[model samples]
Target chain A: MLGAMEVVSPTAPPRGARGLHRFANPGRFLRLAGRALPWVSAIGLVLVALGLVWGLFFAPADWQQGDAVRIMYVHVPAAWLASAGYMALACASAVALVWRHPLADLAAVEIAPVGAGFTAICLVTGSLWGKPMWGAFWVWDARLTSVLVLFFLYLGHIALTRAFDSPERGYRAGAILALVGVVNLPIIKFSVDWWNTLHQPASITLTGAPTMYVGMLWPLLFTALGASFIFAALVLARLSAAVMERRIRALLAARAEGT
Target chain B: MTHLAYIVPAYVSALVIPAWLAGEAWLRLRRARARLLALEGGRRR
Candidate 1:
């Protein structure tokens, strides 16, 4: 029965992973989240604190754009995660579809809105920065266009994932769509060189030296790392809540049947 | 004015959005746990 349909078999709880079994149980997950909550909150506070201080006050202004370039401290990291997040969702959705990991689809569903929010932030800030730098609030420039497409792709996934009467069916359909949209990720990345666009070439790229100075690089890097962690913490926190909601529904159903 | 005028909004949004979202998530988690505890405690009695 298990072989015919993909299922992620729960493994035996590992040694030294003691007390973590509760995370696998909804009650346990909630308890653990309460205990771990302070850590996530504290780390988030500290990371964001150090990053903003260094980014806003300590970092030197760019010779060309002066302090206006500080926007990149937020914009670039947000853009990176916007795409990176979709890729994460697509991968999780694939695993959920194929392996039938019980929590995988829930994780994907939980993350979609957050990803879309970040993508929107990236676009708005990019446009704001571009108006002065590139002379327009909007452009069909290749990079801008592709990024817009990415935003739509995120919206599409969110919609399709929740559309079906059966949550499982919605999950499967949304998973496939997410996998298909993965093709757009690379196109968004190379849009600058792939076609002439008003958006400036990448400030940081895989093949070449970053255009930013060292003083600027450190805080930006910190912000990027913190943002990624905060995203993880938020998604995990939401998933835990979702699991609890399901349990409450189950308990209520049992009571209704008993009555 | 120089680019100094733009800094306020940039820093403000950067600080506000993530902080708000994370704070909201934390609060929801807290509330859900409290509700669950009350329900579970009642169930035991």
Candidate 2:
């Protein structure tokens, strides 16, 4: 069944360049993206709606945080995606730098702004939640500070990628910045434990069972999944735009040369 | 209803930002597609 889908899907990368070439082809990518976009968009919207309704209306509120706890439905997922998006950006940057993959470079460049936006959402929502729970709107604690730095790193990556007239130069500069900025991810993850800050420690741990009850946990997971799918859909849409723009530029260059 | 202010903004920000990003991405895709089509059409002419 999967093979059959692959055969029919325009988005399926051809079995070349060790499979990377299949997706590396912008034309194939655009076609695949076109087919997948609506499904992703629809599923993402439905899941997010269900998650929000379950979280905001049905889930039990925290004994301590009260209704303010509802913020977690949105905040946690945005924070999760913010960090995950950066990791993806770093990986794409590595591929662009090492493999000289044009599509990888474009993906790296396109992902920055989206990641930055997620980081901003995470920060703002964190502040909103913090004000009621922590008794303050903003804090320079380790976790908060590291996430702030992550946001800055994102801004820096965006600026660097657009700085040079030559796209390749911009990609190289941004790739290096992305590679270096990865150090912040671990710090953000461990900051709550490493230092005694106002921010709470991880509720969801890898080894032990989740501290949260199933009612709250299920909604949180749903929201996280919904947000992730939405992020993927956005990335695909942006990547298609970038690929199309690149093609336009190439065609224009060829026309100019001919004239 | 307590802390409704906080809850509302958080969800709003979460939804609005991604929605805006999606809209921007879609617009860019449409513009780029149109430009590519026009450029190719002109070349054929």
Candidate 3:
């Protein structure tokens, strides 16, 4: 099932992508990923473990929400990554569509499932947090609805990428879907301010100081960094596997022809 | 145990979902590498 490929080999550049033609060498990418995977996996997992422990036990509880606020350590990171990862997926899609970068296509494919998982965590944890805070598990507030749309977009990208027998077609279709879904990012970002929603406004912003205390903020930052690294590691591993699987498929094809 | 019911599940889901995905990613990479090795070695022989 994984053996399916396009007329052009996975390693070969697609027609009309001259700008990135020089970096089309798959061997270099495989070698680089191989060297980096071990360090990434080790560091990412350790940081995540440490962050979770610190946030759970050591970090001071909120003066108001108390221990329930501990859920933010997981929820906020998931929410941040959910948005950031989609931005990444969209950028990868743009590269794939514009430059016909095969690696970019593989990257988009790999990022979706992981991105979807993180988004799921965001939604689930948010709902759990809401139960105590808002007296409701689900709501149709702007922030929540927009995030739900983002989740579906991720699912759509995943399904579209695997829907066709030819990987090129799947990649092209998936790329288009990802690019179209890029509009939702800003909506999700400003949803709280755009309307009077149940969701709280952003505590951290690029321009201003965080509204949260240092005691609360540091754990979130640590977990966010840790989870982001883990996310990168997962995507890299998946990309490497996909490339190897393609080579194996090509090799099997050659042997079949020889036989 | 203030909201342990909610907190426990939230923490569990956060850990379990990513861990499951990470495990699957690792398994896929391991399988691909092993199969690729076998195929290349067979070709040489």
Candidate 4:
């Protein structure tokens, strides 16, 4: 399913591999990722800083929420990335299971913990915002509780993917778990509207204009995009490392066999 | 500085978790690259 693109043995001559298969070669991926890393990291970090500065200082405070709404700058983006990152993880899992793409398997492995980190940020920041506005550090609200479930789902995937003796079996199991856990995403999105929850309905929708003021909305958008890029860069870095790790194992095994 | 306790912790986490994650990932990638390069260099020699 992965075509002729193996690990492209370090000792072997470069093949004239073509099409999607060409990029599948781990060596080519490493080269491309190395070239892209600095640019992605610089742009992402810069945008994130600029957007956060605008939100913290220049964006108009909500009359209702006052300065507490400033917490949304980080919280909302973390929430977005947490959910969106899971979607990417599931998609990567699907690609790995169906096509046996080695890179997709590696990507699925890497996306879990970073996605969990974003989820933790979302929860912590939301709690911070809650203390001032809702008078409690936390509540059993639908949105809040559902996101906590999402965080556990990430942890579950991480544990399952490493639970087996065989790497292939572990990856297969993790991919299946990720695909199943994707059912939670839609539930998390609609939980607020489905239940009489304290959490408000989404302020922004694809079909309608954002309910948030323009001054505040722009920074939120900027930071979300910036954070998403950094997410990509992080995953790419991990994937390269994973590929090298697999190769190192192979090399060690081969030396053992030769002796 | 209103609600200094809440807001400070919130931003601190927003900054800290990602930094920790990025640092860990970069260190892993660097270490793996170094090891792989060393092994490849040994094999070629």
Scored by DockQ, the top model is 2
Model 4 residue runs over 4 Å out of place are A1-20
lDDT of 3 by residue, A1-259 (tens): 0221111223454456455665555665677677777777777778888888888999888888889999999999999999999999999999999877768998999999999999999999999999998999999999999999999999999999999999999999999999999999999999998998999999999989999989888888889998998888888888888888888898999999999
Alpha carbon lDDT of each predicted model: 0.73, 0.86, 0.87, 0.85
Model 2, span A83-173: residue lDDT tens: 9999999999999999888699999988888999999999999999999898999989999999999999999999999999998999999
Models sorted by TM-score, best on top: 2, 4, 3, 1
Which has the better TM-score: candidate 1, or candidate 4? 4
Docking class of 2: medium
**Fnat per candidate:** 0.34, 0.89, 0.76, 0.72
- lDDT per residue for candidate 3 within B1-32, as digits (tens), equals 47899999999999899889878887887788
Error of 1 at B41 (Å): 2.6
Candidate 3 stretches greater than 4 Å from native:
A1-23
Best by lDDT: 3
Instruction: Rank candidates by DockQ, best first.
Output: 2, 4, 3, 1
Model 3 in CAPRI terms: which quality?
A: medium
- Cα lDDT tens digits, model 1, A100-188, are 76667878887887788778778877876776666677989888888898889889988998899988899898899889989999998
Clashing pairs in 1: none
Report the first chain's TM-score for all candidates.
0.85, 0.93, 0.91, 0.92
When sorted by lDDT, best at the front, the candidate numbers are 3, 2, 4, 1
Candidate 2 chain A has its poorest 10 consecutive residues by lDDT at A1-10
